[model samples]
Target chain A: MDEKFAAIGEAMPRLLDGLVVTIELTIFGAIAAFILAVILGLAAASPAKGFRIPARVVIEFFRGTSLVVQVFWLFFVLPLLGIDLHPMLVGVMALGLNYGAYSAEVVRGSIQAVPTGQWEATTALSLGPIQRMRRIIFPQAWALMIPSLSSLLVHLMKGTAIVGFITLADLTYQLEQVKRTAGTLFTYGVVGILSYFVFALVLMYFMNALEHQAKHKLGQGKSLWRILSPAPPASTPAGGAS
Target chain B: MIGISAAFEWHWSAAAEVLPTLLTQFVKVTLLVTVLGTVIASILGLVIAMAIRVLPRPLSEAVKWIANVIRMTPIIIQLLFASYAFLSLDLITIGVIVYGIHYATYMSEVYRAGIDSVPKGQWEATTALSMSTLRTWTAIIIPQALRATIPALGNYAISMFKDTPYLLVIGVVDMVNAARIYGGDTYRYTEAFTLVGIIFLLASYPTSLLIGRLEKRLAYKT
Candidate 1:
């Protein structure tokens, strides 16, 4: 027991280095996913069949495959095309691209969840497409996306472990090194516990903050959900449910 | 170790030599694991979801917290912790316990959502009829819940297949590990690793297509 505790103390600096990589990956991944997903979401929600179908295809393709496969492909196959990127770049790019695809639908769905009346209002006022989105759609759309987006961030943080697979010295990789040197179960637990500590803290913090922001934003306007004809409460009255 | 040299020139001869065993035994192990993992995951997941049903609001919330805790942890780490942590302690039971527990959390959420989507009125109707709760859940709630959840269960199955690689770390010698051995043996990473991923796609793609169809059917039904 004491050995484990002491090993954690000794392992702190190296793990902290690993933690830095994890955080950097998480932050970059979240930002890239957010930006790309916004574009993806916009493309998906577009009226043009040309735009929407391809975007939907990209979204499902990435969403369907294992993320580790994507990372490996980028790390290995891209160099065959002379893209010879750094390992960190490869790891980050893979995660961002893969996750961006999934988040796109989430973004598109949330934005579309806004009532048709809101779109009609913008159209009636002669608002351009961008203006309609920026002013009318985004503010309310953000509220809907917040809960899911918060969840996605947590997943993104966890995804940093895939970096370890790419031979990057991320938290999981660091833990493996620590385990080899320390050879103790306690040290392994410490690694899980520490990473979990950082993850849970960031996750809960982001979620709560978003919850606060969502409440504040939605508190002001009469909701689009309200204006869209509300469904009856309780599926108990549900019909034709086999 | 197969060493570094044989890994580069990965030969058909090597893969071909392994083919007889690969075709039969690998398929048996793969199917065994996929089925076992899915069944155990479904059962455990339902139990966890039922806890949400029976538990008080605060307790359900606690269950959600536990679920997130599991969800946030990587499958690889959990597998390692299972094989090493428990095995070292002479607790082999803990390995299955870890997989079942971790996967169960996600599975439970699937069940919870399905159960939640079941009209609240169904429960009230059962109460109105003075029917036993178990009978009501069995006859009504779960049937609907299972339908609602089949796509999700299919997802779990695919995920479990991909996750077999984690077992390699625990000395389970699944396909990924098998390829690694081939890569090491013949100095041929290109073929072995590529084949392993192809095998994964072969399984995952069809399973995913099935899920997409199931989702469409459910959406149409609703």
Candidate 2:
């Protein structure tokens, strides 16, 4: 009993260090993803096939293939192709790119949801496209995108654990080390719990705050949790996205 | 890491020897994982979703937290961690558990939506008839929830099938693994990998269509 607890105490600090790396990857990747999602979303909104076709292809390609392949390609193959980014960078890129695809759709949908009058009004008022998008549409679209974006963030955060495989030494990798040394289930169970505890608080706080902030701007506010809480998916439209 | 455009010429004999084994094992492994994972995920997801919906804040909050943690971690990390960390000897068990739990988090959210879709008056009507919770759930809640969720549930099943490839990382020798291994061994990755993916498309595309059909049937009935 004493030994397990002692080992856990010792292992936790080490695991925590790796978890910091995981969190670091997630946060940075999320930033990259958000930026890319917005750009891709805007690109998809382009009326011309010149922009739209390639954007759709890129989105479909990423969304279709397993992200694990993308990560391996970035981490291992990219090095051979003369881009020797560290595993962490590869992890970030893979995650950011994967979520960016999903976010693009979210962005497109959100932008589309803005009342058609808003677009015409902006046009009649002689607002430039950028001005109209920035001032009139961005806020409404942000609300629509919040839930999808938050879910994407959570997925991205989880994806950081993959860095462990390329020998980048993250929480799961450390847990693997602990498993080897301790040779007990206690090590993994504890590590999983701590990870769960940390992520729960971080995700809850981050997403809840966003929900609250979005709700205020949305002008029909609810409790933060209530707002972020997954709504029952509206009955699947006969033509819901395939 | 290979390019999507890579084209490696393959010898006929090498193709003959490898393709059949690859297809057979791929089906065996994918089917095994999908069945076990779906059963575990569907049952657990329903429980967790309901628990999340009805439990006190702390418990609901904890379940949500746990789900997020599972949801965030990549399948490879968990697969590696689970396979090597505690149960190296039982590779398939660890693989199944990890994937099931991973999808379970996503599934719970699906189920939660299904549960919430049940109108409040249904609950009141059940109560008025003095039905027990189990009876109310079995007879009313689950049927309605499951029907509403046919398409979503099918999506997860297809997802699980597509995800079976992750087992390749841990050396399960499924179709993807077969392709990778054959490529590594013979330098003929193109035919093997592309064929394997085509097979996946064949299996999943039809299943996806079936789900769509099921969704329509359920919609009409409701």
Candidate 3:
């Protein structure tokens, strides 16, 4: 047990390095995913078949296939076609494309969930298509989609474990290294999972704050300040001014 | 690296040669794990959902906490932990159980949502009729919840099927692993990995379509 603790102590710097890589992959991948999701989602929700068809094809193809295969294809096969990308890039691309496809559905659903009254109101105001979506539909939809997007973001973080397969030393890979040196699966495994759980909790808390802020903007939920502060008495009404 | 001319070629013959090996592994490992895992997940998830509803507050909270931790962490690490911890168990068994339990957490959320969707009136109706707790669940609550849950459960099964490739970490020789093995031997990765992707698309796309249809039908009925 003492040796195991020492081993873990020795492994801390390397584990921290791996955690940094994992965080980088997740952040980059999320940016890529968010961009693709909005584009594909808007396309899918468009009135034109021209826009919708290709978006559907991209979304479905990516959604249907496994990420492991996609990552491997980019890593192993793309080079054969004379388009070699760094493994980190491949990992990000695969993660982004896969989760982006899933998030596209969430985007489309939330946009459609916005009431028809809002659409008619936009039309009544003579708002152009881009203006209507930008000024009205998207903001409402954005608030609605944040909760689902939060879950997907967490899923995307967990999905970063796949990077280890392609030889990126992410947190999971580092934990495996720690296991080898620490010579105990139970301790390292518990630590490995706890670290991820902690990261996930932090992410959830952040997303929850974001969600609260969005809802607060739309006049639906409590102020961010109220939510962050100490809880009030049980008899106090929600959204009341402090 | 070998020249693009030699490496990038898509030979139908190489694909055909690799197909049988990958397909065999797909049936033996991938499909088997999915079927068993889904079964385990479906049953366990319902139990968990019910336990959360009925168990005392602290105990239910504990269960929920465990489930969230399991759900939030990557399945790959869970597979690794299970494989390492249970050395006596074969990797395939560990794969199924780990996949099952990992997914059960997600499915429990689905089940919980479904159960919550059961109208309060139904519970009130059961109580008014003096129905036993088992009968209230069996005849009133579960039937309604299951209808709402089936399509979502199908989606999770498909998700699990795509995820079975992660079993490669535990040396399970799943379809992707079989393809990787074939590619390792022949140095022809494009055909094998592409075929695996195609196989996944073929298998999952139609099922997702069916699930979409089922979702629509269920919505109509409700």
Q: Which one is best on TM-score?
A: 3
Docking class of 1: incorrect
What TM-score does model 1 achieve against the real structure? 0.80
lDDT, candidate 3, B1-222, per-residue tens: 455757789999999999998899999999999999999999999999999999999999999999999999999889988888899999999999999999999999999999999999999999999999999999989999999999999999999999999998888899999998888899899899999999999999999999999999999987
CAPRI tier for the interface of model 3: medium
Per-residue lDDT for A100-213 in model 1, tens only?
987897899999999999999999999999999998898889888877787677767766776776678887778877886566465555567557656757776877666666
Better of 1 and 2 by TM-score: 1
Candidate 3 lDDT tens digits, A90-172: 99999999999999999998999999999999999999999999989999999999999999999999889988878899998
RMSD (Cα, Å) for all candidates, in order, is 8.5, 8.2, 2.6
Q: Pick the candidate with the highest lDDT.
A: 3
Model 2 CA deviation exceeding 4 Å by range: A8-17, A76-85, A220-242, B1-22, B50-89, B127-135, B168-171, B179-222
State the RMSD for candidate 1.
8.5
Please state the error at residue A175 of candidate 3 in Å: 1.1
Best of the two (2, 3) by DockQ? 3
- DockQ for each model: 0.19, 0.15, 0.63
Residues B13-108, candidate 1: write the lDDT tens digits.
766665554444347555556666677788989988898789899998898777776777776677666667666543224434555676787788
Best by DockQ: 3
lDDT of candidates 1 onward, in order: 0.72, 0.75, 0.92
* Residue A131 in candidate 3, Cα distance off native in Å: 1.0
